[model samples]
Target: MSGDLDLELDPHAVGERVQARLDEVERAGGPAARAAADDAVRELMLLHQVALTRLLHGLTALPGTAAALPGLAADELVGGLLALYDLHPVPLADRVAAALPRVAGKLGREVALLGVDADGVAHVALTASGCGGGCGGSGAAAAEALTRAVQQAAPEVVEVRVQERAAPAPLLQIGRRDAGVPA
Candidate 1:
C-alpha cells in the first residue's frame, strides 16, 4: 500500500507513456495483435468514461459540493472530463483566450487573441512589453512560445500564426513648402 501511495503520476504524462508502449507493442505484434490491443484499450477507455460520468453526475447533484473545490483543480478535472466526452461548454476561441496569460508568461510579453479561423488556425498578436528592440531571434522565440502554449491548451487548433503589430506610419507634412521642400 505504501508503494502504491508513493507513485504519483500526471494523467497526461501517463497517457503519453501508455501510448508509446502501445506503439511498441503494435510494432512487435503485427496487425492482428495490434487490433486486439487497440480494442482492449478502447474498452478500457469507455469504462473509465462511464465511471467519470457517474461520478460527475453525483457531484453535480450535491449542492455546493463542486463550488467548494479549488478553482484550478476543478477546471483541470472538468476540462479533462469534458474533453473526453467532447462536451466542453467553453468554445475553442474562449479557451484560447484563457490560455494567453500562461503563453505570455513564457514569451515574456503579453499575447492577444486575434481569433481562430475556420481552418483551425489560431491567430495571436504579441504586445510589445519586455520585448524591446524586437530582434529576429526574439520574434522567433515569441512565436514558438505562443505555438507551444496554444497547442497544449487547445489541441484542436491545427496551426498557430503570430501576427506582428503594424508599426505607426511616419507622419507627413501637409504644408505645400514642407511637403515639397527640405528644411
Candidate 2:
C-alpha cells in the first residue's frame, strides 16, 4: 500500500490538493491543453455527480432508507460529498442559519445570518442581547469562529463577515403623575 494509496482518506485535504493541481494546470498549460484538462475534470465530476444522484434517489425510494437522508446529510463525509454535488437536501441558507445559533452560544450574543452575498460571503449580524454585545474579548475571534462554523457546515460559503446590528432606539417612559395626585 505504498505510493498514493498510502495517503490519508481526508476528502477535503485531497480535494484541496486536486484543486491546487488544477490551478497549476491552468497556470502552466497551453490554452488548448488547459481547456481540455478543465473539460475532463468537469466531465469526470459530472459523471460522479449523476451516479451519486441516482444512487441517492434509488436508496431514498426504498421504504426504510428514505428516513436516513437527513442523517446522511448531517454526516461529515457524506454531507461534504452531497454538498460538493449540490445534492444536499438542506439549503445553504438553512445551514448557515443553523450555524448562527452555535455562534451565538459561543459569543454569548444574539447572532444571525443577515444574508449570504453572491460571492459566497456570509454576512452575520450580532445583536446586543446579553452584555450589550460589547464583551471585552476580540470581535475577530467571533468572526473567526463564525467563519469556521459556516464553512465547515457548508463549504460553498467562501468567507464570513461579521457586523454589529444597530442598537434599537431607547424607549422613553413619560407618565404624568396623575395630575399632582402623588409625588
Candidate 3:
C-alpha cells in the first residue's frame, strides 16, 4: 500500500486523482483493491504531514525568512491567529454583546434590529449593540455613520442599509451589498 501510488500536493489534481481512483476501486473485483486504495490514501496523508513540517522548519530556521512572506507579516499573522483561534480574545459576537452592557448601563435599556443587509461582509456587519447615542445622534444618523465607516474601511463594500427595530429596543439590522462585478 505504501508503494502502490505517488501523491502530488496540488489540491485540484489530487481531487481528480481521488475521483479516478474511486471509480477504479468501484469496478475492481473485491477486497484487495479496496485495501490497496485505502493504504495509498493513508500514505499520501503521511507524506503531506512530513513535507509541511519540513517546510515550516526550514522557513523558521532561515534568518529573517518568515518576515518576508506576504501573509506571514508579523501583524497580520499575529492578529489573524489571535482573532480566529485565541481563547483570550473575546468571541466577536460576545464582544458585540458585551458592548450592550455598557450601553444598557447608560441608556437604561437595550436595542434590537429589524434586519441587516444579507450581502454585507459578516465581520463588518452591525452586531447586537451599536455605536451609542453619546454623539448625540439618532439611530438613522448612526446607521449612516456606520455605513460610511464600512465604506472607508472596505471600499469594496458598495452599499449598506439598516432597519431600526421598535422603540424601547435599540435594534438595528444592517445589510451589506457587494459592488457589482465588472462584466
Candidate 4:
C-alpha cells in the first residue's frame, strides 16, 4: 500500500488471489486450522486498516494537499483504494462511466453506461461492434465483465444489470402467395 511500492497493484486481482489461498486452506485443513487462519487474516487486516487510516490522515494534513486529490484519484491502483475507502474525489456514477471503455476493451465490444439507478444498480448496455457476439463475448460474459469493471471503479455500486435485448425478428416471412394456384 506504500506510495513507493510497485505501481502495478491491482486490488481486485490481489483480493482474488488471497481468497483462493483462503479457500485452499479451508479445503485442506481442519476446522481449528481454518479458524486460526481466519483470525490471523482478520487481525492482519485490522492492523493494516489502522495504518492506512493514519497514513491518509497524515497525508491530508500536509500543506497544499487539497490540490492533489483529483490527481491521486485518477491513478488506477490508488484510485481503486480510495474508492474502496470512500475517499475518491469523483462521484460513483462518474467512476462507473469512466470504466466503460475498459469494460468494452476487455469484452471486445462497445458498452454504454445506461445509468445508475436509485438502488445503486448500474445499468450497462453491451452492443456489438458489427460482428455481433462472434467478435466479442456472449451476453452473460459481457454482464460479468461489466459487473467486475464497474464494481472495481465504483465500490459503491451494489449491483450491475446489463440491459436485456429483445429477440431478433425472423429473417424471412412465409404466407399464402396471391391466394391462387402457382403459375
Candidate 5:
C-alpha cells in the first residue's frame, strides 16, 4: 500500500470483527483448510508471544521502567496486548478493584468487589437505589457497565456476578420500645 490508512479502531469492535472473521473462516473452509488456517494462527501467536516477551524484558531493563510500566499497561491497545501476553503490570485483583469506582460513579450506587472466585467469576456487590423486592437494582445499563469495566481491566475473569447487598433496616421504627420501667 502506498499510504497508511487513517482510521481509529475501537478495541471491542476490533474484537468482534476478528471473531466474525474467525467464524467465517471456520464455516467456509473444509477440514484441511481449517486445519491449515488454525495452524498458521497458532504459529503466528507463538511467534508474537516470544517477541512480546523479549520486548517486555528489554523495556523493563531500561533505567526507569518501574515508573513507566503502569502507564503503558493502562493504555487500551497496549493494555490489551500486555494482558494477552500475560505481561500486565497490575495483579488481576487490583485491576478488578480499580474498575469498580467508575461503575459506581455512573450508577450512583455502592459497588464492591467481593472477590474473584476459583472459577474465574468476579464477585461484585452493588447496593442499588432500587425500590423493594421486585426491583433489579440499577437495572441493565449499570450491570452492563460493571461487566465491561471489570472485564476490560481484568480479562481473566470469565464472569462478573453482581450481588445486591441487603440495605440496612430503617432507623426510625414505629413499634414501641421494648418493656422498660422508665417508659
Candidate 6:
C-alpha cells in the first residue's frame, strides 16, 4: 500500500520537473532555443493532459474526491500556464482597434501608388503602364473599379457600414454576432 502511494505521487513530481524545464527553455532565445522550447512545451502539455485525465478518473472512482482535487478551474489552470509564457487572449475589438492605424497606412499607400486624390473618392491603377486602358475613368467608375479589383485581390475583406466616429480613420469591428448576445 505504501509503495502504491509512492508510485501514485511520482507523476506529480515528474510534471513539476517538466514544467520547470519548460520555463527555462522558454527564457532562452534563438533557433535552437525555439526547438528546445517547443519540445518542453509539448512535454508539459502532454503531462498536464495526462494528470487531468488521471484526476478525473480518480474523482469518478471516489465520489467526494472531485471536490478536493485542486479547486482550480480548467480555464484558470490554462490561463496561468499561458501567462508563465507571456501569452494571453486579446479581445477582437482591441485587436481591431490596434490594427486600425496599420490598415489606414496601407490604404494611404495604395491610394498614393495609384496616383489617386484622397478627396473621399477611390481609384485603381495597374502596376504596368497602359494596362486596362490606364484607368482613364470617372471618379465613381474608378472607385467601383478599384473596389472590384481590391475584392478580387483579397476576397476575405468586405465593406460594411459602421457607426461614425470623430476620428478621420475608420475603425474595424471584428467578432461574431449572435442574436441577443452582447458583442
Candidate 2 clashing pairs? none
* Alpha carbon RMSD to native, model 2: 4.2
Question: Superposing every Cα of model 1 onto the true structure, what RMSD results?
Answer: 5.3
Q: Record all residue pairs in model 4 with backbone atoms less than 3 Å apart, i.e. clashing.
A: none
Per-candidate TM-scores read 0.65, 0.76, 0.32, 0.59, 0.80, 0.25
Span of 10 residues, lowest total lDDT, candidate 4: 164-173
Residue range 1-183, candidate 4, lDDT tens digits? 676996666776898998888888888997777888999998986776677778878888999886787788787777767765666778888889999998788777668888999888999887654554475777887788889888877877999998855444458977777857775
Candidate 3 lDDT by residue in tens digits, 22-106: 7689588466877877788778877765665576568768998655543442233332333322211233334333333343344
Best by TM-score: 5
Candidate 4 Cα lDDT to native: 0.79
lDDT of 5 by residue, 1-183 (tens): 537753455777887887777777878886677777778878998899899999889988999996799998887777877877788888878999999998888777789999988888999988866556454444566778899999888777889988877766668857767677566
Backbone clashes in model 1 = 0
Question: After superposing candidate 1, which stretches have Cα over 4 Å from the reference?
Answer: 1-3, 6-8, 68-82, 87-92, 105-110, 116-121, 127-137, 151-159, 167-183
lDDT of 2 by residue, 30-70 (tens): 67767888899899999999999999989988999877887
Question: Compared with the true structure, what per-residue lDDT tens digits does model 1 show for residues 57-100?
Answer: 68768997666433432355456556566445467788788888
Alpha carbon deviation, residue 91, candidate 6 (Å): 20
Q: Return the TM-score for candidate 6, rounded to 2 decimals.
A: 0.25
- Which runs in model 2 stand beyond 4 Å of their true positions? 1-8, 26-28, 117-119, 128-136, 166-183
Q: Candidate 5, residue 52: CA error in Å?
A: 0.9
Q: How well does candidate 5 score on lDDT at residue 23? A: 72
Question: What C-alpha RMSD separates each model from the true structure?
Answer: 5.3, 4.2, 18.2, 7.5, 4.2, 21.3
- The candidate, 1 or 6, that scores higher on TM-score is 1
